[model samples]
Target: MRTAYSVETVRGAERELMGRLPEGALMQRAAAGLAVACGELLGRVYGSRVVLLVGSGDNGGDALYAGARLARRGAGVVAVLLSPERAHQGGLAALRAAGGRVSDDALRDIGRADLVVDGIVGIGGRGGLRPEAAQLARAAWESARVVAVDLPSGVDADSGEVHGDAVRADATVTFGAYKPGLLIDPARERAGALRLVDIGLTLPEDAEMEALQHADVADLLPRPVPESDKYRRGVVGVVAGSARYPGAAVLAVAGALRGGAGAVRYVGPAAEAVLAHFPETLVHPGPPDKAGRVQAWVIGPGIGEEADALEEVLAAEVPVLVDADGLRFLSPQRTRERTAETLLTPHAGEAAALLGRGREEVEAARLASVRELAAQYGATVLLKGSTTLVAEADGPVRVNPTGTSWLATAGSGDVLSGVTGSLLAAGLPARDAGSVGAYLHGLAARRAAGPAGAPILASEVAAHLDAAWRDVTD
Candidate 1:
């Protein structure tokens, strides 16, 4: 697991470490690690031109001290101080003593440099780059290979919000722990590649966010055995679709088939259409209560405002996935009454309805919304969009990396519900089922739409699920 801490947590950790060591020790350690990384980028420390975009805080101090290390190694290093008067005195002294030069004519000479280090703002920064800093960052991005310290300047280290103009770095070198902003979208895209350096800071157990590494995902995936029979593999009951939208039923079944479920029992008015499309599916034209025994249940998809359908599924004694239209009729109190696990998958629009907020409001603060939904309903929440977020009731949230804009097509979400439901039926934990299912769903979409931008149908995405699973596991 790749954990992310809040800016406050990082600052507290830095302060604790600073107090335990001698004066200037922590900053020196950060600077030395940064300098080594810069050296690797330049191939050789000697004869390389290095430019530092210095800010007013300790962030600028880190850059200056790192630049000093390069200067001592025979590299031509220059510091472009954004706030010369407020810059860290100790760091500035170290840089000058090591033969590094300070220049105000940085913009004109910046293009000639081999690499640029953005130390304009650390975790303390609130908004994007200030006007002057923004101008410099834009220039550096256009010409030089940029490396960021701690995080890219101008991004909200806590929320991952890019207020205005932010630095887009070729690589970001973080210390101690990852920041939530770096793992999330918008700001995540700006952070090209990530590197973590241990500065011996102990993180709190209550960190807010996390990302799953390959090994973690591998451990979470379900493994089948030779003794597993059709029922033993798990049976999924799907209560989705209506007369108005029968296609959703077909797409949902398509995803369920790709999942490792042995059988699917579908109950809805669209049973005839589902049977016609997928003859293997066992269709029942009845209510959810009489749908028979299933290890897990998937509800909502194309279901309109049918309160009976929603209530029946909610009362089930098995793990349940409530998505799309099912989200409309859900009540937190009702969800809490259930004995089995409940998972909620809502796009921004549906999430807004559940929270009684605007769609834009939910999108802008997706992290908060997902967490709030989890806390409110006492269930795992999966907020789907550009950056799909999965938050457990009392655990750290996870942001999925594999996604594309093409997934916005209609019925894609329905497929996701089915796949996740099947995983739940196969006895996987709610969090793992939701996260892994999302990863597979996104990869399948990418595979279906090849390099030439082939138009992909929802069924085609389901067809590629097995290939995606193999790619990830292999």
Candidate 2:
């Protein structure tokens, strides 16, 4: 797991480690790692022209020290001090000793630099870059491949919120643990490729937010056994679609077929439509209670305003996935009363409805909104949009890394609901089901799009599920 701790946690860890090590040791370690990274980017340290955007904190100290290291190795380095007086005194002295110069030349020699190091701010920064820093960052971005110290300056270290003016780095070299801002958007979007440098700081136990790695994903995947029969794998009951929108039912069933579920039981008025598209599906035009036994249930999707259908699914004892129309009819009281594992998959609009907030509000702060929804409803919440976020009722939030903008098409969410429902039926926990399902769904959409860039249909996405699963499993 790739863990992301808050900015406060990182500072606490830094303080703890700083107390144990000799004075300036931690800063040296940070500078050494940063220098090595700069060297790698430069290809050859000798004769390379490097510019450092110096700010008024330890971040500037890191850049100045690293610049000194590069200067000693024959590189020509210059530091642009935004705040000359407040700049790290020790670092400035070291750089000067190593032949690094501070220049007041504005755009004259900046565009000619080979690399630019952004040391404007670190985790301690709250808002966007100060006026002077922002101007320097803009110039650096236009000229060189910018590398950030700690994080891209001006991005909220805790929330990933980009305030006022921020530096968009080509790559961010972070110290200690990954910040939540590095993994989430809009700060995440500004942060290009992220590189974490271990500074020998031990994080706290409360640091729980994380991103799933390939190995962790592999371990959570469900596999079939030789002795396992169809029933043994698990049965999924899908209550989706209506006379008005039967296509959702077909798409939902299609997604469930690839979920490693033993059997899929469809209970809705759109059975004929579902059977027409997927003959393998066992459809029933009866209520959810009459759909026979099932390990898990998928509700909503294209379901119309039918209180009867919603109530029947709610009464079930198995794990339930509520999506689309189900989200429309959801009440705080009903959600609070849910006994079994409940997973709520809501797009920005639906999430807005559930939270009684505007869609823009939900999208702007997706991490907080998802976590709030989970806590409010006492269920696993998956808020889908540009960057999908899944949050459990009591655990750290997860951000999906494998998604494309093309997934904004209609009916895509329906397939996800079914796929996650099938995973739940197959015995994966709610959090795992939501995150893994999102990863698989995004990969499948990418594959289905292929080289021609064809518009991916819901069924095409479902068809590519096996290939997506293989790519992850292998």
Candidate 2's TM-score:
0.95
Q: At residue 315, what lDDT does model 1 achieve?
A: 76
Evaluate model 1: give its TM-score. 0.91
**Backbone clash total, candidate 2:** 0
> Per-residue lDDT of 60-179 in model 2, one digit per residue for the tens?
999999999999999999998888999999999999999999977956557889999989887888877778778888998999888999899998887777768999888888888889
Model 2 stretches astray by more than 4 angstroms: 450-455
Question: What's the C-alpha lDDT at position 15 in model 2?
Answer: 89
In Å, residue 394's CA in model 2 sits off its true spot by 1.7
Residue-wise C-alpha lDDT for candidate 1, range 1-474, written one tens digit per residue: 788999888989988998899988888888988898888988998999999999988889989999999999999888999988988888888889999889769887688889999999988889777899999999999889999998999888887778889999999988889999898767887887898888889889887897766667667777779998878999999988988989888889889878878899999888888888889898887777786789999999888876588777877789999998888889999998889999999999999999999998887778878989999998999999988999987878988877577788889999999999999999998898999899889888889887666677788888899988887788
TM-scores, one per candidate: 0.91, 0.95
* Backbone clash tally (model 1): 0
